[model samples]
Target: MTDTVLEIKNLEASYGSVQALRGVSLSIQEGTIATILGANGAGKTTILKCISGIVDPRKGSIHYLGRAIGGKRADLIVRMGIAHVPEGRQVFPLLSVRENLWLGAYTRTSRVEALEDLEAVYRYFPILKDREKQEAGKLSGGQQQMLAIGRAMMARPSVLLMDEPSLGLSPKLTEEIFTIIRRINRDWGTTILLVEQNASIALQTASHGYVLESGRIVMEGPCEKLFQDEGVQEFYLGQKEETGVERRRWKKTRKWA
Candidate 1:
């Protein structure tokens, strides 16, 4: 069996006249979390959009579990066992927590298997069970994020693409959410491709890392190597005044997307 769960080569995508992903390529091994770190408008999200088939790649190929999927439809991709939980935690605000979770299984082939997966999700996140009847919008930010993940879990995906899972969250909540992500990876063995601007924690969680700058991969290696490098301080650790004005410039540049 191929150790690589996903492979992207010569990926290029554009919206109108504006190019987003530019000749990007990446490979993700099965049963590991691989994070793509970059600043806002750096095309991190565009990579996810392309892989999930939200935007068709203008050029290049995407292979999922050895099957070419670059041109497939988004829904078709999800049913193929790739679930994308997009940037904004796009939950159904009006729907009940239970209803939102149930909707995730809409594409599943068997209702019984979907129900079994729902139970598994509840085991992973008991809060969703506690708030089963609550309106999704009424939940706290952390609860809402949990619901978003829970909804994705209901789809029974083998590969989970999470975009900015900790966006707009408190530090405590971010830690909590990342802990769940770790458990999900270790326990369920689902391969994950996480896109985030929070490089510090993201690198710590991922087995390997890739650093993206303005739609291109500028650096990539072992997570520990990138973690200790001085360059990582530019984006991950925040800049330093001792390094002078050029280094000070990073303080103003928004990294979050």
Candidate 2:
């Protein structure tokens, strides 16, 4: 049986007057990929922020490896083996690609281990190695996304929190990025909590899924079931199921034409 690596219970967070997460609870088993599906302003990112200590929760518990980590310092959280790749691929533009990656290892105590991990990141993204000395801002969107993931990997995290990794990229590039994500999980046995707007890809990539709406978890299940759900089909996948009456009407209208 797999162990629960990360767990969140009754997670509540806010941004001043606005309540972001409302009693959110979820758990991820080790070596598995879980996904959070939601629309804009659905409090998905807030959950990540709370876990990573970027935003303090009003009330709740976040446990990683059986240790309570909610509201801990952000850097401390990273040192505890949870790494977050925020949305928008926030790589330092003026910094060299190598420099940006090196910053991820600041939490580590061993220089030699960090150096080895840096080389591993280069192996994961050879393009980054080719441009190690180049300014990060000079790279394209997909390259920057790779840089972001690679930088996060430099920490050798046990749990990777990825937010909208496919944001602002071509279809092909999105596929490529997800391929790397799968590779990372399979090779490193890293647990992943992915928050993605692209429902089709998210459902395909993650084994378990949770749907969020207006700061609450509305549905939770295996991705296979969620993919076939009528509401999910209509709302997230943009593919609505045709009722018998609707199908008959469509056939009648087609006959007239």
Candidate 3:
């Protein structure tokens, strides 16, 4: 079997006349965490949308496990072992936590196996187990985010697409969530494609990284290289050296594509 789990080539998409992704391409290796980092409106979320079938690519191809999956329906994609934990932690407000998690296994037929997976999810996020019968809407933001991830876990995906998993979270909660994400990757061996604005946490969490700017990939490399790059340090990592010297030096040396 090939090591690459997901591949995108020349991907282009838009909303009406406004283009969101322009000739974007990237790859995720099996059993590794990969991240896409960019500012707001940089087409970060759009890439995840296209992969999960929420939006169709106007051009190019998306291959999952060496098979093209660009135009498949979202539900079909989920059943094919790709689960999406969307940007906004979109949990069902009125549904009990247990009910929401069960809905994630809607594609599966074996009740016994699904129950076992449910127990595993509880083990991963013990708080979800504590709030099993509570209304999902009543949970704290951090708990709700946990629920969103738990819901995706119920699908038992081979590849997990997470968009802005740390949005609107306290620093402590964000660290906790990312810790769980790392454990999920290492323990379950699930391939992940994470999109985030929190560059520091994301770069630290992922093994490899892609930097997107205005709907295009500007930089791609291993996490350590990205973390050490002067440009990345100044722009993304919030490291500003004395009197803006490093910032100016970065601007002079780097050129965008």
lDDT sort, best first: 3, 2, 1
RMSD for each of the candidates? 3.5, 5.0, 1.9
Residue pairs with backbone atoms closer than 3 Å in model 2 (clashes): none
Tens digit per residue, CA lDDT, model 3, 1-257:
63999999999999999999999999999999999989899999999999999999999999999889997899989988999999989999999999999998999889999999999999999999999999999999999999999999889899999999999999999999999999999889999999998999999999999999999999999999999987788678888666855446534554554
Best by TM-score: 3
Q: TM-scores for all candidates?
A: 0.91, 0.94, 0.95
Q: Candidate 1, which ten residues in sequence have the lowest lDDT sum? A: 248-257
**What tens digits encode model 1's per-residue C-alpha lDDT throughout 1-257?**
53999999989888899988888889999999999988899899999988888999999999998999997999999999888887878889999999999999988989999889888888878999999999998998788888889898888889999999999999998999999999998988999999988888899899888888777887877788888766777556685447565655534654432
Q: Report the CA-based lDDT of candidate 2 relative to the real structure.
A: 0.93
How well does candidate 2 match the true structure in TM-score terms?
A: 0.94
Clashes of 1: 0
The sequence of per-residue lDDT tens digits that candidate 2 reaches over residues 14-81 is 99999999999999999999999999999999999999999999999999999999999999999999
The per-residue C-alpha lDDT of model 3 at residue 27 equals: 93
